[model samples]
Target: MTETFTVTVEPLEREVECRADQPILDACLRAGVWLPHACTHGTCGTCKVEVLDGDVEHNDASDFALMEFERNEGKTLTCVATPTSDVIIEADVEVEEGVVHHPVQDFAGRLVSIEDVARQTRRLVIDLDREMAFNPGQYVTIEVPGTDATRTYSMANPPSEPGRIELQIRRTPGGLATDGWIFKDLGAGETLRLSGPYGRFFLREARTAPAILIGGGTGLAPLKSIVRHVLEGGLAHRLYLYQGARMQADLYDVDFFRGLEADHPEQFTYRPCLSDEEWDGPHGLVTDVVDADFPTCRKHMAYLCGPPPMVEAALKTLMRKRLFPRDIYREDFFDASDKATGGVRSPLLKA
Candidate 1:
């Protein structure tokens, strides 16, 4: 018999089962623990946890993922850590008392349409065979046949309609999944297998404060989902969306966002920032625009989605503006590295 291990999480005081061969994060996900995580391949450090007892091995985690100092401090990246014995660890708990997280499951879906939304981005619409009820900011991992690759993309549309999914995909320069299949070979009516409804980047129902939504490039997908959910629900809390791109051509879905602002001027605002090209509207990085507009965010909640560097910078700026760390949420897009290497993209794009 294969030896199984048990994992005890602190604060939440919960237990999850782990197989000898599987990662701790996978086990937690299988048990519906909803521990916060992003990259499942040890690239991103979002799944870092502190080991309190027993033993584990991080044979698959990258050196950049855990420093010698952190390891000495009994910290491990849950995504790559495999239990050698029953273990206890401290990690961020995301589950609420009455809320349930639908466990990850495989579903069949077919491509409905693909449209070029920007110079290097495409909007993909899919019709799922099963009703996959997911949070607005969740994503699904899609399998690409004829190649050992998959792409992670967040839904641009909310879960208002079942069996329907929409995604914005950015074309990587030399990506195996994007260049080979997503761009050149895949077509409508093609069947695809997907598993997920993963990610903790969704909107918090309990937050009644104003929301500041920020995104860069195709990172706007999940933010779009949240915005649609907020607007459709007729929430009175103010909403601000800041979308950044390199040039005007890189900007997509401006009309929809603009329409949203026009419809609810008192409750919503949209700002598009350009970094490379000269623009009459907001200029420089999205963080710069945010700093220029909002001097303080003491009472607002912030949701950021973008490249890691951009997300980090924006987070720092928001913190400087008086937003507490607990009030700020982020989802970093890891497409370039994951897609080029033919590895699974970070689950941030999935959920």
Candidate 2:
């Protein structure tokens, strides 16, 4: 039997019950205490906190993400560190308005359908046992069948369409979640244990600035959710969505987004760019297209999701175009490989 302990959080002075084997961040979130977190697997270091007292076992946190020196200095990555005793820790609690906090919970999902949506990409439609309430740009962690591993994916559908989930997955050769399961033995009608509403990269409805959305590869998933939420609710702000792919064959949901643009010309703009192979339709990176379309973004907000390189480049481009760091949101789609070679992360960035 796993022994439970009370973990005390500073500043707020909140307490949450956590099992000996559970991560502190997991306990905090489930208790409705939204501490800062990203990558949830200890690679990104966004959930780093200071252990003001008590001890913990740092469970699979990468040395690069939680430096040895930092560990010696009483800092721990709350996402991967499990409490050994009653603990007191200090974590950054970001308060952003118009963002609804949803407590994380587990759900039993049945895979209703799966099909190829693009080159090396598949679209999965899952029906959950019950409805889940999440923000427009949040994600879920899916447990890989026949293994103890799990993979995280952003939802492509909006919260309004609860009880059903649309997931866009990009196949990675020999990858655990991709090759070993999803693209391999997984099939329709299969049941999966998954959890949600993780991540903080959702749309900020309180902000009045028109938004610029940039996505690459399967990064388009969460962005799709945001698009639907805004358009369906008839938000007044304009939206410019740019999706970058390797080529025409690599892109998906063309006609769908085009239909959206046709219906909402004044409020919606869609641009799909191809980088590798092009045959006459916005040839270049998506960020390059955004750079060409907008001369400046002084009073606009931007949401970027994709590979780290693309996100980094877009950050530079947006900042160069006069968008402040606070006005931009990013969610880097990291994988197991990224967990191996941990990359640089910022406290200001929302996952």
C-alpha lDDT score of every prediction, in listed order: 0.82, 0.90
The runs of at least 3 residues in candidate 2 whose Cα sits more than 4 Å from the true structure, single-residue gaps closed, are 344-351
lDDT of 1 by residue, 260-281 (tens): 9999999999999999999688
Model 2 weakest lDDT span, ten residues long:
342-351
RMSD of each: 4.3, 1.4
Clash-forming residue pairs, model 1: 137-351, 138-351, 139-350, 139-351, 198-351
Candidate 2 residue pairs in clash (backbone atoms < 3 Å): none
Clash total of candidate 2: 0
The number of clashing residue pairs in model 1 is 5
Cα lDDT tens digits for candidate 2, 107-152:
9999999999998899999999999999999999999877887789
* Deviation from native of the Cα of residue 254 in model 2, angstroms: 0.7
RMSD of model 1, in Å? 4.3
